[model samples]
Target: MPFALYLLGLAVFAQGTSEFMLSGLGPEIAAEMGVSLAAAGALTSAFAVGMVVGAPLMAALSLRWSRRGALLGFLGVFLAVHVVGAVTGSFTVLLVSRAVGALANAGFLAVALATATGMVASDAKGRATSALLGGVTLACIVGVPAGAVIGQLWGWRAAFWAVALLSLPAFAGILHSVPKGAAGGPGVRGELAALRSGRLRLTLLWGALVNGATFCTFTYLAPLATEVAGLGTGGVPVVLALFGVGSFVGVAMGGRIADVRPVPLLVGGGVALCAGWVLFALAAGEPAVALVLVLVQGALSFGVGSTLISQALYAAPGAPALAGGFATAAFNVGAALGPWAGGVAIGAGLGFRSPPVVSAGLVAIALVTAGMGRRVWRERVGSVSTGAQDK
Candidate 1:
């Protein structure tokens, strides 16, 4: 991988810290802003909504712009918003800043994905994608916990300030490393036309379903660890860290082979994920078992999820810029829906373990979708071959 890809990953780490750190600071934010806890939590929802909307919108808007220029512009916006969020007195201002920051984050991620793959060999796209995504796993492991600690020690505002400061190096690196005038795609019209491909559509659906399954359980893991597994509050972070470790390993290992053996890896990982979730739900009362399952589940979730994302990019060859945006939108759709489904289950008296069960069902559906995607891929390839023969 190019050093530039590592810089992109570093940028993602800074953005991802802002994205996930809010989870730990919700209560502090609520107290400081004189709002309900739910309202503070809504900040996260606002970010998710922004990401879902911004990915495609920003990608299209910047499709013809210099890649380096777009990346620097987004990072500048992200840094400015965090500063605004840190200084804002009104809760409304903070909330709006978070959403705007997410718009920039989403745009950066989309462009970074296209940029990372472009820097690598065609056969190594999966590895390039994983290299970029590794920053997210690292943020989950190091950045979020560090941000939480910073918030707990100083104040929530300090955490926001930290995110702003952390992004400075990334902005500098991108400006230095990324080539000037490297526009993303052929054009907006060409990208839009590529969206009509059946393979691309199914792959995007696969990405959504796989991610929905992962987050449905992951979003509620803390409660499940404490209530069902009999762990104390102190143990919750341990479980989360363990999951992050497993995810890092998964991405590192799976990236090596995902491009070469996408079908087997996808099918195998999905099946394992479904079974792992089912087992997790059944063994929720065992503290030791729950801990181990969390790690395994994280590995399976990210391994398959990353592969699906890489496949989406491969599926949309004609839409280099839009492909990353579509993949971003797909994953965020699941990120939003998965937690909602989990919340609905718990709200309806299904209990903490229900989320894992729900995840299993989601994975099963993903498996079926993967099968349909395989057929579509085959048909598309066959038709192209037939057209060539006729010519």
Candidate 2:
């Protein structure tokens, strides 16, 4: 909608790069830090855990800060942590830095979503959320790969440095453009009280489940392509690129349809996401087919993701700030859990394809959750209208 919303998206790109670039930098960090790759992988896990808890923690802690101030505060922490990480030689310190950085990233994103939504008409929430999330998609397409290359050419620290440098412009843009919008919804007590809503909780669960579905399959995508689809290591990025392309397409289309038909987008996208995973697993041996499925799966993933964000804002229209933070924490919880679940399946000899099966179940849950929430929400609204008419 506004130029500031685009600025928020760019800020998202800066933070999101760190979220994914570490996936490709594990080996380098492991070697440099003299830790096992498993321990290095734990650094990524710490970031996810921080993100999973960050927003709620911030919402509870910083109930009085202006949206613009909160955004800048998070970015400042993120930038400083990245700089510290870039210069650090201690593995443990790096781990701590990653966690703090993720916390800041989560806070920034939650506020950004709330602020963006507040800027637009109620009907345009989807487009606003999508616009902000487009940063993550662009990072998937560009930043993560570029960071991988930077890591290989220079070092993992160099990638962190690059991210830190990028944060400068994002911080300036946010500071210059983002208004000090009044916080939406309730304060700390209000957020806690609002959590009691079954409908709100259901929406949060749906957010988590949908993300879990995507990550469950996505965690094993590289192995699936190499072992089952018969692709070389180099081809892995190509598959990821295809997924990114689909994400871009999905988010763009979802932005257009979300305000007009949020339920259908969530329902149909969730269903399509499940089917895509099933077909992907079945076509694991067919490289072309698997590649095509990657694109479709990516599209469905973001289409559903955008809908969840839109629904979160609409469902808790009174408390955009708190609802936004809570929704983010919910999604990241799923993001953290999905990979763990997939790893469990693979560990049990279910193979790479098993991940998609696991993901399919998650999507099914999300679909059911959405259906239940929609029904309950509609009934609640109808009751309110009936009460008003009687009065």
Q: State which candidate has the highest lDDT.
A: 1
TM-score of 2: 0.94
Tens-digit per-residue lDDT, 11-46, candidate 2:
799899999999899998999889999999998889
Worst 10 residues of 2 by lDDT: 382-391
**What lDDT does each candidate get?**
0.87, 0.83
Candidate 1 deviant stretches above 4 angstroms: 379-391
Candidate 1 residue pairs in backbone clash: none
Candidate 1 local Cα displacement, residue 189, angstroms: 0.6
TM-score of each candidate structure, all chains considered together: 0.96, 0.94
